[model samples]
Target: SNSALDEIVHRIITAGLTDAKGETYIPSIVRVGVNAHHSISSVSMDSLVALRVESSDRAKGKRRLEKDRARIAILDESSIVASTLAFSGCSMFSRMTRTFDVVVVDEAAQAVEPSTMVPLCHGCQQLFLVGDPIQLPATVLSDRAKDHGYDHSLFKRFQTAGYPVSVLNVQYRMHPAIRSFPSREFYDEGLEDGPNVVADTERPWHKHACYGPFAWLDVRGKEFTPEGSGSKANRDEAEAALALVKDLMVRFTELREPGLMAVISPYKEQVRLVKSLFRDKLGAEIAQGIDVNTIDGFQGREKLVAIFSGVRADDKKGIGFVRDERRMNVGLTRGRSTMIVLGSARVLRKAGPWRRLVRDAKARRALFPFTRPFDKSIARLTSDTYKVEDEVYSEEGEDEEWEDDEDDEQDVDYGAESEPEGDWIPRAEPGMSDDYSDSGRA
Candidate 1:
């Protein structure tokens, strides 16, 4: 969302505003400034020093305040000023004597109403709130505070009051296959794919059936919670996920790059376990290249490929946080090229949206039952050895070789501790090919 805000600012500075058609009006030259936290100040725009207002001495504090005011005065000269929500309400901004003509809050659906009010209080005549209420809401830690509706956002409030909200119907991030189910289930089939992300714009990995635009590997993994821990982890799902990643890396050379792929889970314990397993099996350097995070933390982020591990498998537990449709929407829509979900279909089918998801995958012929050990099964599917190429070195004018443990001949068993019943595993649809070369267009 910060990127979206930054893009908006950049467009305003470069091309001013444009109409729906291709017409653009170049406005008179105007200065624009952005104020943000020091950590995120390295944005596309020029960075400014974050004002520090704390001081122990009265004289020093007065001088600091005066200097900060001078800095704020520089921003006041700009017709357009952008700042983070917290920075907009800082002491230095409060001391400024200028008011804005318009205030735009990006990601308003994820900000609490009180926090959203901070920028509006700067005497802006018109306001615009930009966000999707269907994705995720503001997070409230206290149960009591949540009961008092502290998590309700101003964007949702306006929508609830029957405001005329304009919907942006075309999405450019996800492939058409990856966007289909979420569009139909969440947006009442109103969302459409942009021209750039259609089936013709397929990535190289799309040639492999298993690495198609969308697929769900039915991992009948059992979930377990550790002692003194509230989060859950599934060893089977993690192994399957790792095996998928390994296969992708070996098959496609581009996937080896960092930040191109991500492995997300709903539980912190599962994220920790997946990271550890990746380090152990893939080695620390390769593992460090992948992004592993919780589903909540991965919101508003996209990757070339995404592997989601649904860690809740017990029927009695009834799918835990996976049942939250908002979180599900965010998790399902994060992949730009490919989206692979590993979970127990039996348990996920108990929830309404998940049931529809599973049914949709089956109907699209993208659902595969993962019943065998990942190493052997993936090897059979891809017909490729699960080994990384070794590096050669010539040190001190002598020919030498560098060997990696991952390239060793030792066979490691990365399977579930217990197998599920045969009835729980669904057979692949008729005419489905096990060959990776087959295009599995969903």
Candidate 2:
């Protein structure tokens, strides 16, 4: 949607003109989404980090000082710099401003507290506030607004907030399978009529296989495992996910630096587990970009092989993975080639407000265009296929030969049990397409 939306906007303004005679679309939407419901220029990342610390502060409290100084082993430079919101001797608020060609605020309703934007919108003018107010507003301002010296109701704030606001009446992001949920939960004005939003219920569940080599790990078995008992049962899931990653290494010999895989968990400690595992096995992994979290992790990056290890099942249990629906979706869609969900969906339901309105089967059918299987007659990590050209191959000096298997191994097998790289498949290997090659790095 990001690229396509930009392309459409460009086309709309320029009449879709290019160097060619006919109209064509070009995506020129350069965007930088500085994380927050608040204004980008008004806020700073350090301010947000400090806000997190301030949120845990007590109205009347001070730290009890221990007489004995703890052992200080200086690894990196240790210092307390001025926070973005607080101007200290080491820092200035104006120096930390981030600039972008195009700036837009997503989910503006959630940014009710103007204080969050006070440090960000110091110079922001070009801004776009986007979201549905029917759902929810910012928690900070919504709660204890009188104490913050504000008396405006949320409805009034919604009516008068922002400058030059526009509504995205046309819904486009959701798959048709689950649009109804958002319609009920979010869309107050509802969707504008359009053919782009269509349904295809005819596709069978098995017909729409997931993006390969996708695998869903079940950690539901460890839902009731006792934690903080000094045992590693809680840590077992992280360890198992690491084991799967190692299995991938042994299974795929051609796994290059970029192909080693990543582990994504909503939890930071689980991410630490992945880093430690990589350190214990391979050296300090530079490419193991798995710990990209719900907070500032994988917006501008992707991995070819993603192993999502931390799937939290128990909502009340505290260590469960899925903390937010949007965060889970971000993790789910991060895979460029393959997305391996290495945890149980059952376990994450324990987190309250877990509403899976659309079953995965239905959602996939509505999203993907082609539900066809990968061509069997392909070879290598390259996703190419032989067209069954003449049912024979006589290239080079070799004699013409039919693809019919030998008298013994005549049965073609392309089952799930078979390794995709192996030549024991039902079809013979094909010539590589220009875009594809012997290596599966792409």
Candidate 3:
């Protein structure tokens, strides 16, 4: 229930404001599909819970589910707000209440199943469903639905029932490169053609002396589904990812902008493993005390130099949970300059929709070579070396455990690696060159 509803109550109660540190405290829904969560168990399969509820279906005819534990807790106070998977015309939510002041539904796409929401619609006067249908529609994934798809989930159904509705169109999510395709696919038609190579630079940022803050590689990785839902990413891949991390350290030293680089991936396990190994081996060289965050974490932030960790197979299946196309868009957009994905062309080829985007991105990057730097790129890889430990989450109290007292963030900069002056040429197509067709992030 980290839905917008829950965030509002949590922030208003804890921070005493509707906004905290600039994050909107307004009621909304939240679902980090996967990867950001260190544990696969982080997200709930409430669809399964709905089945459980139906089989046992306790609180039978109980009228008010406000007391139900299905929704997560946000505030300890009298009046509270929560996100419900329940949807339009669901009777359980219609009751006039001393129970809640307002209710919102997060993951509105998932909540689109009207049958599951039948109970909540009964008691609530104010209801809202906030989700992007373009990301993933709420319907059976049949070719039939794919052929005749429509956006009319419960929220859309409410509009069909004659309720006045609102649409929030500002996309505060992706970088211009990654956002372009999804926007064209789901948003403004005018937003169709992708990437802004010269918008911010003088007369031509595209070729303006080729600023070195760039790295683009057509990546590839092996394909093998892990044993269980909770299984970790391939350890061999993790070790290779560490080598890439070390390479980034070298790049950061060249750029001398240690504080300006970031490492993004689609997998949380990759993030944990890379961060732990990088810290243990080169703790003194990291930008600062900041731990690695995945693409979702780096969203609103841009880096002068970016080191993207590619842990997916090259053919296509991209990485992590890609049931929704929106995630692929998010991953590609993490870097402003320099994005290096280290997977095989085979994996990218395997990802049908993703292949199109990768092809497009590589083509766009090739049309203009200097956009992101990949020159002087070198990788030293060795596998089956150290057995990566079970992923660990640093506790709040132990945040300082990784800190280096003698090291300041600025001291870690690798001078020459940051600039454009070396004989070392950057590769537009690094690993998965065979499949890239030269499409890359702008």
Q: lDDT: which candidate is best? A: 1
Clash count list over all predictions: 0, 15, 68
Candidate 1 has an lDDT of 0.67
Query: What tens digits encode model 3's per-residue C-alpha lDDT throughout 111-224?
Result: 435533653543446656765544433544345654554424786566568877666654432345444555665465434322344242112122311222222343333434
Error of 3 at 216 (Å): 4.4
Candidate 2: segments with Cα more than 4 A from true spot: 1-112, 119-125, 130-215, 220-233, 247-255, 258-261, 286-305, 310-327, 349-442
- Candidates by lDDT, descending order: 1, 3, 2
lDDT: which is higher, 1 or 3?
1
Summed over model 3, clashes come to 68
Candidate number that wins on lDDT, 2 or 3: 3
For residues 40-75, write the lDDT of model 1, one tens digit per residue: 343322333233333355697676666566566655
Output the lDDT of residue 378, model 3. 31
Cα-based lDDT for every prediction: 0.67, 0.35, 0.39
* TM-score for all models, in order of appearance: 0.71, 0.41, 0.44
